[model samples]
Target: MDRPTRWTRATVYPDMWVDPADDPRNSDGVSPDGELPTLVDYLGRYRATLLMKCDDLDAEQLARRSVPPSTLSLLGLVRHLAEVERDWRGWITPGAVPPRLYGSADGDFEGAAPDPSLVARAFADLAREQAATDTALAAHPDPGERLGADGIAVRELQVHRIEEYARHCGHADLLRECIDGRVGQ
Candidate 1:
């Protein structure tokens, strides 16, 4: 029986983006053993993935919407994630958190206009917030450490962060593909 073989996103490439030896996100034989390392490693990888998805794109491409009604764009995700990181910093640290990066409720998405300065600012904010969040998290090494009045464990929050990044990275994958038809891990 003769049949046609259709190439899809999955079967299109056994190795999605690049060769294993050349993949920057590769663990490089340093396997994370503890809960903290594992969670942080995952979070870092997802963060890197999102940045990689946005790489080489200009302001217009980065701000391009996924669909007509949806405001899901790579730049928007970056801003949203920056907001999330800032929020997380507020939770973990005992300092007065700054106001939202974008003033409006939907500013993260709606405010992601296709401007070169806005794109630069968004990436800069993301990096700054992520570094601050990482530093705050580092101060409390114990997984069982509680945060805020709700008593959410540091471990739990870390897991939640990983989940958040994972979900958004998926969105980023789609958004990037929509912009340039490039697909991979």
Candidate 2:
């Protein structure tokens, strides 16, 4: 039996690939003028990077667990990120964070099965949640603006969003590499 050749994706830069066209999310010349926009731009770039890692992979590949003691997968990442978006967006409001997207006790990871339907739903959820979050942030031009009874600063949350995306994108990179040799920043 012969193994198939798995080609590692070639990137034009450490942070981006030379795809059919340039990946706009590769942080190409991301010149953010203000703090809020900077944070938003970073978060958006990481979000796109995560999706790029999962691009063109099948459901099974997306759902491949990281290792024996973990259930982390690209699908899990997608679901988890969606939940993260939902939660943080909720926090932007004074009210309690809305109910989590996945009600399962195991959290978003449990719903991360290798099914095309799940993949579709996860992406849709992320898009809708991101749009809502962006709208919420857009209402607050000043990053110093505070919200809620506890007075959580919008800047803190935006920066936190960027951090969260960055961390998850790191995890996603490993998962993607494990699924295939394809590696990129």
Cα miss at 20, model 2 (Å)? 11
Name the top TM-score candidate: 1
| Candidate 2 C-alpha error for residue 178, in Å | 0.5
Clashing pairs in 1: none
Q: Which ten residues in a row have the lowest lDDT in candidate 2?
A: 1-10
The CA lDDT of each predicted structure is: 0.85, 0.79
Worst 10 residues of 1 by lDDT: 1-10
TM-score of each: 0.89, 0.87
Prediction RMSDs, each to the true structure: 4.8, 2.9
Which residue pairs collide in model 2, if any?
Answer: none
lDDT (10s digit) by residue, model 2, range 52-141: 888999998988888777879888888887888887777768766688888874568877898899889988998898888888888998
Off by over 4 Å in 1: 1-15
